[model samples]
Target: MRINVLQHTPNEGPGSILDWAEVHNHEVYTYHPYQFGHLPTADETDMLVILGGPMSPNDDIDWIKAERKLIKELLDNNTPIFGACYGAQQISKTLGYPVTKAPAKEVGWAPVHLQSHVIPGIPETLQALHWHEEMFEVPDGAELLFSSDAVKNQGFVLGHHVVGLQFHFEPKPNNVREMVVNDFNYIPGSILKQTKEDILATKVPEENRAVMFRILDYLSQ
Candidate 1:
């Protein structure tokens, strides 16, 4: 399968998802809208993976608007999509869901409690990498899949094809480390409060990855 990844920034790339794709012999292509232009058509894509970024979905960026349009097109055609963090917020907004600031930002590793059987193949609890200030409301007609202490709408499913997650199931150890070291500029709040050491310590346990892989495999199906 040809999986197209929509990357929002240089630091935010497909991590473990890329590994999964390579191991499964799937072709992976990426479009960095911050550096490149807007997203391309999904003509050749069998799956769409939207990675996270520091920006909000409501940002008045031209590229973000274009990507939202592309997401709408993909949804209209029933193309499989998986969105993370900011990407998930975009997906929610494009589908008429409201994206708003959370009571507090959720950073580092967190636990998401599965709210429903939306992702039928996955288990009930999973630890995932989270770094975001905003949260989205579950779209109308979409089933809520997961929730965290900081965010209620952590994950949702639209039909059988589209999945939006507010956490990072795709980050490998190195990916998380690089994000902390290089992308620390994007981190808000007290810089001294959240150190690179703290971020590096964040991890998704192996059991969580097992459930994540199940969701990924289910979406691929």
Candidate 2:
């Protein structure tokens, strides 16, 4: 299988997803649209993984629009897509859902309760890394998979192949470090947020990685 990744920034690459793909001997390709405004065609990729970024899907950028177009085309063809944060917003936008700012930004570890078990392997309650201030409405016909206290639409599954998560389930420890270092401005000094040290101290990586593997395995099937 070939997995094509759409990366919006240099810092946010597929962490455990790439690792899983590599271990399973699946070919991987990446498109850094921020650096090169080009994207891979659906014919070239078996599955698509869209990673998070600092930018919002609502941003009126040329590349963002192009990526949305690509996402819509892929969904039309029933191509399996897994998205996180901004990537999830893009997917929601493509499906005619509204992506809006949350009442409060969630920036640390938070428990997301499972609303449905369509995705499988995810526990009823899981602490996922949160870093975004935006939340999207669940697309029509998509199963609302998860929800948190801060965000009502934490994740949703479209059919059996496409999933969009609002939190960072694919980030490793190093990925978190880079994100904190590079996007330091996002760290608000509020109760809902966390300090750099506190975030680095979490033991969510191993469990998050395992869950990510299960997600990929389901998508591949």
Candidate 3:
């Protein structure tokens, strides 16, 4: 399977998703919109993974608009898509749901309360990495899988192959560090957000890694 990942920024690349792709022996191709990388058509991609970024889905950018069009095509064709953060917002916008400012900016490790069953054997609550101020709304036909105290629509599941997570499950410890280092100012000094040291110290546990792998496998199916 050819899993195509859309990367909006250098720091926010496909972290553990690369591990999943390698484990399954699936071909993985990453496209950098900032660099104008060639984007393959929906039929050429087995799965599309949209990674997180600092930008908003409502940005007046050409590449961002183009990506949304591709996402719409993928949705119409029932292609498997997994979006995180900004990527998730993009999906929601293309699905006719508007992206709005979250109640509070959820940064670092926070617990997401699972509201529905998207993956089997999943915990009722899990500590997931988050770094977005804007949140996506639950689409008309999508199921609200889980949410956090800071944000209600943290995740949604559309049909059998489409999923969007407002939090960061794909980022490994190093990836989290990179994100923090690159955009340290984004994490405001608030009770809801975490400090750089605290965020870095709390490593991405093996449990979280396993859960991410399971979720990816579920979407790939």
> In model 1, where is the ten-residue run with the lowest total lDDT?
186-195
TM-scores of the models, in the order given: 0.91, 0.96, 0.96
Residues 1-221 of candidate 2 have per-residue lDDT tens digits of: 88899998888879889889988999999999988899998788789999998898889999999998889889998899999988888999999888898767888788888999777777788888888889888999998988988678989888878989999889888887887788777778534667877877887647788889988888778
Off by over 4 Å in 1: 185-194
lDDT of 1 by residue, 23-106 (tens): 789998888887778577868778889989878888898999898888888898888889999888999999887889876677
lDDT-better candidate, 1 vs 3? 3
- Give the clashing residue pairs of candidate 2, or none: none
How would the candidate models be sorted by lDDT, starting from the highest?
Answer: 3, 2, 1
lDDT of each: 0.81, 0.86, 0.87
In candidate 2, which residue ranges exceed 4 Å CA deviation?
189-191
lDDT of 1 at 140: 87
